[model samples]
Target: MSSMLSLRNVWVEYGEKVVLERVDLDIAERSFVSIVGPSGAGKSTLLRLLLGQEVPTRGRILLDGVPLKPECGPDRGVVFQRYSIFPHLDARHNVLFGLECAAAPFTGRLFGRARRIALDEADAMLAAVGLGDSGHVFPAHMSGGMQQRLSIAQALVKRPRILLLDEPFGALDPGIRADMHVLVTRLWREQALTIAMVTHDISEAFTLATRVLTLDKRRHDPHAPHRYGATAVYDLTLDRRVAAETAHTASITIDDNVNN
Candidate 1:
């Protein structure tokens, strides 16, 4: 219920073009927030700001009431639409890489007892993502769903406080996307993670998120579209009971479609 992330009058501009302006938001701890908007609405840009990959052109961003760092840190983990795993490494090793990087930044490797422990943790994370038996499988041999599970495992191995998802299931088949929906919902509950996901699907936004945010330009300039920037035009907070009902209804709808 406490605020985990706060953006105060944030703005992101590039030279003469403005992307986001006068954006103010407060994301609570352990809350699942879904961002939905049209193309060029700066949805991904907002996600990047939260990931510490980009800083605001003005205003301040606070994490747990402290000023956020300018670089990405272990406290936040991100899963992109494309699988961000190493093709050469197997599932276990791919997950292990995160631990190794955090433990040994200079060499990005571990050894002996440390190596064994890290592998155990990696296997545990893989199991959590339903890839326990596939630890030895290479990503190239795995199906799309399996590869995405591996990607989630890799992001989660570091045990980040916040998880940022950018159209993570957009590329999957409908059946696979439904399965991933269940997987992500379960993980979000089990891990008690604060998730901020940018999605193109309106149904997905309502189904998975405790809060839904729509970004768009409040005032458009016909002469110069770039003269204005997008902001949170609509913010809707769903009650827990309503969110559960929505998820249930969505699941049934997906099941019916798949059956047909």
Candidate 2:
């Protein structure tokens, strides 16, 4: 497992306010990492940095040992807390849209063999995320869990090297969320994706991540509470067996659904 991404003494600030400070981490290939923290702890900020949505005020972010550019690219994909799917498009088209946007940015359309290939890929991606039969339905008609699965499929249609998730299951019911847990773990394994997820649920973080990172404001100063920003306060590498058990249990849950 070589390092896929690395943050070296990263810092991010907006105007007079600081959001992150001295954040250093190395993310291995095919690793599932979950980030947890209190409110105002800059968890989203970290995700944005990785997504290349925002550049660090100082320091560097590297991918494959090269400095990462400060912009989103095909190499990385993201699923936000919100469904992030278009209401008008059906599930299949929603996934196809990602391919079109990436392949034909100016016209936002795909044609000929490229179009057929993308559509075929989209169908496979939708089915992989457990929405094979629902491709004709719009997001508005789908349940909360289904919409989230659609979101995941859209991100994955591009076959990104890294996947970033922001509270992907926060809006679902408990049972649906559990099913999603299984779906996501299965996708991670089958696709060999390097994942970085931001989740407020401590239990969810512990359950899904091979590595857990806790971010918080680490420096305390009586003069200015906000002067210092958040950083990785705790990093835990779970035992291999624990992660295996979680994936195993989630698989059983998915199997039960099929039987039912």
- Top candidate on lDDT is 1
Worst 10 residues of 2 by lDDT: 251-260
Cα lDDT for residue 172, candidate 2: 88
How much does candidate 2 score in TM-score? 0.92
Structure candidate 1, residue pairs in collision: none
Local distance difference test, per candidate?
0.92, 0.89
RMSD for each model, in Å, please? Answer: 4.8, 6.8
User: Candidate 1: deviation at residue 176, Å?
Assistant: 0.8
What residue runs in model 1 are displaced by over 4 Å at the alpha carbon?
Answer: 244-260
Query: How far in Å is the alpha carbon of 89 misplaced in model 2?
Result: 0.7
TM-scores, one per candidate: 0.94, 0.92
Candidate 1's residue-wise lDDT over 20-68, tens digit each?
A: 9999999999999999777898999999999999999999999999999
